[model samples]
Target chain A: MTVADVLLLALGAIAVGSGALVVTSTHLVRSGFYLVVSLGAIAGLYLVLGAELVAWVQVLVYVGAVVVLLLFAVMLTRAPIGPSADLDRPALPAAVIGAGVGLGLTALFVDAFRWTRFPSPDPGTAERLGEQIFGAWVLPFEVLSILLLSALVGAIVLSRPDIGARKAEDA
Target chain B: MPLWLDLLIRVAAVMAGFLVLPLVIGQAEHKVMAHMQGRVGPMYAGAFHGWAQLIADGVKFVQKEDITPRDADRTVFRLAPIVALFPYLVVILTIPLGPGLVAQSLDIGLFLVLAVLGIGVVAVLMSAWASANKYSLLGGVRGAAQLLAYELPLVLAAASVAMAAGTLSLPGIVEAWRPWWLIWQAPAAFIFFIAGLAEIRRPPFDMPIADSELVFGYMTEYTGLRFAFFLLAEYVGIVVIAALTTVLFLGGWHGPFEEQLGWLWTLLKIFALSFVIIWFRVSYPRLREDQLQRLCWLILVPLALAQLVLTAAVKSLL
Candidate 1:
């Protein structure tokens, strides 16, 4: 196998293994850290796939912001140093769902590509990605921004009860 | 030299810079702060104005007991220092000292640097939570909140410069820089420098580690080499922040004898900015937590947005 293929396989293995640890680890804070490892491995996979912008953004938004927030929340609450017995739940249903999803994705991928090798695309630099987004995907991009903006507004309103209280009182 | 030798030399040079420059900045801080406060600092260690004070400190840190609290999570507590220090090492690799002088240059060098730097927060959170100290946990939560708030303006201010330069590469941004940009990008530059200071948790933006209130904050539970690592990381952070401010705003490697002495110019600017950073520490007290948040969201964020718009307008015009 080519170096990229081998690297991809290794990173994928790490991602899957850490992802399993993220779900199965009884320690809440440790599970959050495992999620970080899983996400970081996925970013490595993106790097191996030659999507540098996506890889770094994945690290930035997910690892840097999302998981930090998750860890922050876990810490803000009771995060016992050792594993808590209360975290334990029936594993059978979770395993069944997980396996079904994994198998379905594998089957779909196999059905679609079936061992065919396609030429790799050029690396996705910021400039090229920008062109793609602004050139062909402008409408969807704009829609996404609007959606995010609304979500942001919703959050602000929810967080500050006084924001809409005065308006209602005036009415 | 062969390709391997060339790569080896570059890596060694970056590593040497990474290890040495932070100590230099630390010594500078000691001398500057001492002088500013009208006191003689570190006069005995090396007998030459304590040139070896940090080295002495290093030995002391190494000799001390490595203590992990009984209640602490051993694994995560042990892991924190490495997490704190590693990002700065990665960042230095991408920073260009001169034309073609970088150890490794990525197409998205600026983004990579910022992203990696953001990961440093996880270290603080990890240590704070793993220590199982109420003070450390409080400090960590404050740090997260502070970082989360300031991150917006920090990224936004950087985005302004990236927009102005029209490339996310650090070297490309320097190449795109002009003398007039010192005036044009001044606001964005100011925002960037201040926000960068906050990002690194320097004084006046140091609510998270307000030692007076939180007893070194997240670092309260740490001792020995781990504590020393945190200190080293802070100094390295200062170096990174100063270097970034130099590169992004002050026109890195852009001085007389442009071809030669380019790296010297970059170093000069970095040291100058580092001096200013120290001056800031000596001049201002730690900002209150609410004041810090208010300053970031109310002032810096709006100002960064305005600067971004100005950059866009100027870019469109030119």
Candidate 2:
């Protein structure tokens, strides 16, 4: 195998290994940290796949913002930092479901592709991605903005119960 | 020069730069802050304006006890400072000190810099969690909140610059403004500077490590060389942010007589920006966490979005 193949294997192993740790680790915060490692390895996979923009964006959004937010929520709620006895639940169901899904996806993917090699595509440069995003995907992009806007409003409403009470009294 | 030899020379230069630049900037910060506060700073360390103050500080840190609290997570606590400092070194590799001087001029250099720099938040959070102190945990939580609040605007502001330049490569962006720089993109530049300050957790946005209240916050339990690493990372961060601002807003290595003296111009601009950071520290009082969050979410984020839209419109029109 070439260097790229070796690197991909290493990164895939890291992603899968850390993903396992994320679920199995008893420490809640440590699980979140392990999630970072998993996500970061996925970003590395993207980098090796020659999607530089996507890779960095993955790092920026997933590892940087989402996981940070996850940790923040955990800390705010005073989640157990150490191993908690209650975290241990019967693992048989989860294991069976996980294995089934993993095997099903693998079989489906293998059947569909069947080791066919595709021609190398153009590098996904930022400029090209911007064009695709703003050109063909503009409608969905704008819709996503509205979705985020409504989510923001919903979050505010949920957080501040007094606002609803004030509106009810006015009505 | 051969490709490998060229790579070796650049790596060596970057390593040397990393070692020396932090000391110079740290001493500058001390002298400037002291002079601003009407006090002499470290007069005896070097005997010539305390030139050796950072060196003295480094020696002291090395000699001090490396303490780990009994309750601390040994592995994460030990690794945290390395995590904190490593990104600064990596980010430096992509920054263009002068034309043809960058260690690796990737097409996505700017994005890579921002992405790697974001790792600092993870490092800080890790350290705080590992310390197992209430203060450190609070500081880490504050850092997470601050990062979430400010990072959007920071990226948006930088996006506006990239939009105007029509490129994401640092050198390409620099060359785009050959005639004039993107400081003309004034609102975006201002947003970038402010968000960058928050990103680095400098004074006025330094709620994370609010020394007065949190007792150095996430760094409360750290000692010796580990503590020194955290401090060094902060100074290195200042220099990185300042250098980035110089490249993005001011012209990178662009001045009169620039061909021969491009690196000099770059240094001058970086140090000038560093002085502004130091000035902010000396002059502005720290903001409350709520106020900092409000400023970011309510004001800066929208302003940055508007700036991005404006840049897009202007770019298309031009």
Candidate 3:
């Protein structure tokens, strides 16, 4: 196998390994950190696939912003740094459902592709991606912004009970 | 030089530069700040101007006892300093000190630098969590908040420059300043410097490591050589940020007779920026945490975004 293939395999292994640890690790803060590793490895896989912009967005949004926020929440809540007995839950049902979903997706993908191969496309540079985004995908992108805006408003409302109380008094 | 030999020499130079540059900058900061405060700093060591003070400090740090708190997470505590230092080494590889002097010239060099720098947050978080001290935890939490807050403006500011230059490569950005520098984008450059101060956790944006409040912040529990690594990483970070500002705004290696002596010009700009950082530390008081966050989200973020849009518009028009 070539270097790219080897690197892909290594990254995939790290992603899967850390993902498993994220669920199983007893320490709350460590679980958040493991999630970072998993996301980082996934970003590495995106890089290996020659999607530099997507890979960096993954690092920036997922690994940098999302995971940091998660860790901040955990620390703010005074999460136990050591193993906590309460974290353990009944795993059989989760395992069964997870396995079924995983297998079904794998079967669907393999059956649909059926070992077909296509010519490799040109590397996706940021310029090309920008054109595609702003030219064709602009509507969906704008909609996504609105969605995020609403989510921000919702979050603010939820965090401040006084907003609802004031509105009720006004009514 | 042969290909392999050239590669080896570049690696060696970068390694040596990383190892030695921090000491020089640290010493310069001490001396400059002292002189500003009307006191002599490091006057005795090595006889000249306490030039050997950092050397002595290094020796002392190496010889001290490496202590771990009983409740500390030993593995992460040991790993944190290495993680902190890793990005500084990686970032220097992509920065061009002169024409054709960079160790690597990836197209996504700027993105890689910013992303790698983000990893330092993980190191801070890891050290803070592992220390298991209330002060350390408080520091780490502040670090997380500060990083998240400042990173938006920092990336947006850099994005404005990248848009103006039409390339993310450090060398390309430098070359784009054939006739003029991105300092023409004065507001963006100003936002970048301000946001960058927060990114490096320097004053007055040094809320994470507020010494008076948090007892050196997340580094409270660290001692000996491990502590030295943390300090080294901070100074190296200061140098890196200064170099980045020099490259992104002031024009990297662009000066009189720069064709033959470009690296010297780059060094001069980098040190000038470093001196400004020292000046900030000496002159400005640290901001309150809320004020720091508000300055980033309310002021800098909108300013940087507007600058980015303006840059894009100007680029398209031209």
> DockQ (Cα-based) per candidate?
0.85, 0.68, 0.59
Query: How do all the candidates rank in terms of DockQ, highest first?
Result: 1, 2, 3
The sequence of per-residue lDDT tens digits that candidate 1 reaches over residues B1-318 is 899999899889988999899999999999999999999789998989999999999999999999999989999999999999999999999888888777897788999998998898889889988998988988899998888777888889889989999999999999999989999899988998898899889998887788988998899989999999999999999999999988899889999997899999999999999999999999999988899999998999999999999999999999
Off by over 4 Å in 3: A157-166, B1-3, B178-183
Best of the candidates, lDDT: 1
Angstrom error of the Cα, residue B294, model 3: value is 2.0
Chain A, model 1: TM: 0.94
- Candidate 1 residues lying further than 4 Å off, grouped into runs, are A166-171
- The per-prediction tally of clashing pairs is 0, 0, 0
lDDT of 1: 0.92
**lDDT tens digits, residues B136-159, model 3?**
999999998999888888899898
Q: Summarize candidate 2's per-residue lDDT along B76-190 as a digit string, tens digits.
A: 8898999999999998888887887788898989899889888889988999888989999999999988987888888888888888888999998888864444545788788
lDDT of 2: 0.89
- Best model number under DockQ: 1
Give fnat, all candidates.
Answer: 0.84, 0.60, 0.36
lDDT of 3 at A30: 88
Cα deviation at B141, candidate 1, in Å, is 0.9
